[model samples]
Target: MSRLGVLRAVCVAVGLLPALAHAFLVNQWETIDTSTKRAQAAQDVQPGRAWIEPLTGMDMVWVEGRCFKLGSPPKMEGRDGDEGPVREVCLSGYWLARTEMTQGQWRRVMRNNPSKNRKGDDYPVEQVAWDDVEMYLGRLNSFYTGRVRFRLPTEAEWEFACRNGGQQVRYATGNSAEQGSWFQRNSGGVSQKVATQRANRLGLFDMSGNVWEWTQDAYDSHAYKQIEPQNPLRLGAHPFRVIRGGAFDSKPAALRCSNRGFEHFSLQAANIGLRLAAEVEKPVKPRPINLRDTLL
Candidate 1:
């Protein structure tokens, strides 16, 4: 049988393949306002040289890593107690996805429809639990051959990438939602296409207002307060993993770059989807570090 057919069969076995398929094409830049010439000019500038690649059957964005503040400051409006006190964080170079996984991409790999309401290929694939994403990554890792490995971005990485390195104004696009985002003021009551929106300084698309993306760090209301500024903690073994970016149904407040939320790994929700990450490759020797010697 063909690969697509095999995938379909797998979806059926998992009870996630829908009987009928529908296509949902979104305009990647549906909500961008053209009136602001200055903002438009900024948007025109190239975000960066980073490009996306499908690794392990998953689409990922190459992130040229650096450092940044890990949490929200005390005086920002609508600040959550958990978001503070602010701290610094440093990250190694890595790659992340431009947007969350879409139905088309998920079907290509898992051949399933975990979304409660099936949308078109371009719509973010929702209803996937965090643990399910881990399972997907396991299969994806097996599918690719490379030094880089697939996983989720940490909360700090997600914010830093969303903010697009240091050009942070607010919301991935500087200080205005009109530049290239779908929020309560716009969005036309639905999610638009994937890449139509304006990309961040790093050339990442849909980082602010498409869907909330899953991150590697587990949720702890006060974790950021005590953690060191450099090399922000990415404690994945803990319960309640973090999810970033606002979803289609969220209001403007929730779509802010620093906004945060969490959900259990097994509770699938319509607003949740994911982005993939791969570690930077380093030269390897087959037996670089002997396990016995390291143990000593």
Candidate 2:
């Protein structure tokens, strides 16, 4: 047979084979295409509390967890007494608000204005105490069908999420202040609207500056040194809670992910606001069962 004739015969055989098993072949291709589509759809999905209902109303970003060195090195430039003795810490996955809680979100949930100085609906809601935030979360949880809950991130979780699952960067986004953080060099003397600055790699907006975020754990400068890697360490049953990320009025050094501050749970400040954390849900596995033979 000629080479061209042989090639045509091979093509005819291949096409005829598909016709012989058309239904099975079509079903297999459909399954493969469906799986591929599902996987592609998952890639577009964000992680953590952002996937839950109530918190989903606000734009949130996922922070994949890992072990990272926490705190400042002794030789770091402009190091402060509070940044302290460096240490290693491990974190679990979490979601953080893309921006500080805006007055709009606060009003939606709490239904009252607590901010002493209201700038605009989009501005970070300030003058909220830690206790007030907890109260707000309680109400939000009830309003959202009880499926989702909200509370402040623990100190370690706050820092880990703010760092966007990476080691300390000069600012939360990166080393450059020109990247739009409201710090000493660029804030121009006042707090700007939330989300006005560049977002961190995790898509969390205004992590470096806007307003300081209240953390669930209490403050202690040496707290990290003694905490277990599996669990975040909390200082004594103190009235004060940790606050992280610098405010609009802060200097560059203050915005470092390692920097820490403290305030009483009931104390409200113009530069303070709250971001929420909720538990991550894991897929439930089905249990295997033994079926004994039964007589009918």
Candidate 3:
């Protein structure tokens, strides 16, 4: 589902979108008056490289790392109480799946499909718990001994990529949820196939709606302050883990880029799925209990 051309176009469009190439701090999402502005935001998202993993035929896109404020302003629509006490987050470049991990990919490795619906191979695999996802990654890693290791994205990284390199946007497809997402308004109470809708500026699909994506961090309403701002990952044996993006039955407000959701670590639901993320050319290392402690 990766749009190779969009990644290639980033190189051609970089000069045209100089403002985007450099990070500018915007305090708020600001009001979007017309679709023209939204259209321009989508066009200006000069993304990085993209490639496909041959083993599972998974399309991977490179998310170029940059720093930006990590939560929503207090007055923003759909603002959650936990989104406040915003902090800046700087990340390192990493590979992210162009779409949610599909049932086909899950079955190809695990030898069984765990999704409740089991619609087909192309559908996003749901009913996966956090530990189940970790097991899948473990099985996936045994096949490839290369330096690149597969895992769930950290919430910061997920939001950074979802916001199109940390831009002050509301959704992956821009402020409008209608353009490239399947939500309560039009989903008819069902999740659609991955990439059935348009991709975001970074050539990623289903980041706003379709299914809730599990992340590496534990859920903490005060996570922004609990973790370090750089490559933030809130690690703990917490009861709940962070989940990103909304589901097919989710309201548009729930799909906001900064929206926060959490579920018991073992909870599995029809609307929850997982996306793959990876760090390349290095052996996987453990994240710190407190990211700030590692720096000291």
Candidate 4:
């Protein structure tokens, strides 16, 4: 080949490198955005990965481990009396369903849908008591062949996710509840379909409003004082369990990220429901067998 022709080929190849590099970065960027892992970018995805819940086909997001200040600060707008005395909490990474359990998912597991809004299968299942949620989780776990563990998020986990991994936002998405939620003023007095509103930074939906989600924590006015640095699950003989987010009947103030609510464990309401949290089981390694012992 002529020297000029070879030089031209090298130049053309060099010119294409930038475009190729840009495409590669864009691909990884999108993967990071969509992936349900602790990965904030392509570089963060490790050997372990997250998965969709088989029974419900729900998309889950990994909440990365970190320390964050929980509860509303004094004098913050819409602060509840119980939202005070801010606490620092650190949690280990875990998986959380991106949306509330829909009516269709509930029916598939429980053999009956208890949602008051029979208009559509996508609406969050409501009228479920905390006790009912426990039964659903039991059946769901049994269906998985012990591959994963599932339960309600703790109050800290709920608040952390709602704040988009512990940002100090008033609502899940931002300060404006209307932008990220369906509340009394805009709900038309009915539960809307899940994910109809904006999702938080983690791509979780219905985190500000839709239906109040039951947490695993037992309700207590003074629990924040006892928060531990690790994953804190406040369980005791309390009569009421924590309920979070807000409901279709709730006002904007009630939809604030730190707003705390509770319900009797046995009580069910049309606007009360749950979101599921999951933890993948680590693979077990078998010990080496001894041939000498086997001969005996």
TM-score of each model, in listed order: 0.74, 0.73, 0.78, 0.78
Candidate 3: where is the Cα deviation over 4 Å? 1-49, 281-296
| Model 2, C-alpha of 288: deviation from truth (Å) | 26
Residue range with the least summed lDDT across 10 consecutive positions in model 3: 23-32
For model 1, the superposed segments whose C-alpha errors exceed 4 Å read 1-59, 228-230, 281-296
Worst 10 residues of 1 by lDDT: 20-29
lDDT of 1 by residue, 144-215 (tens): 344455788878888888787744456887766667776556776566667788888777788888678898
TM-score of 4: 0.78
Clashing pairs in 3: none
Candidate numbers sorted by lDDT from highest down: 3, 4, 2, 1
Q: What TM-score does structure 3 among the candidates reach?
A: 0.78
Candidate 2, superposed: residue stretches over 4 Å from native: 1-56, 144-147, 281-296
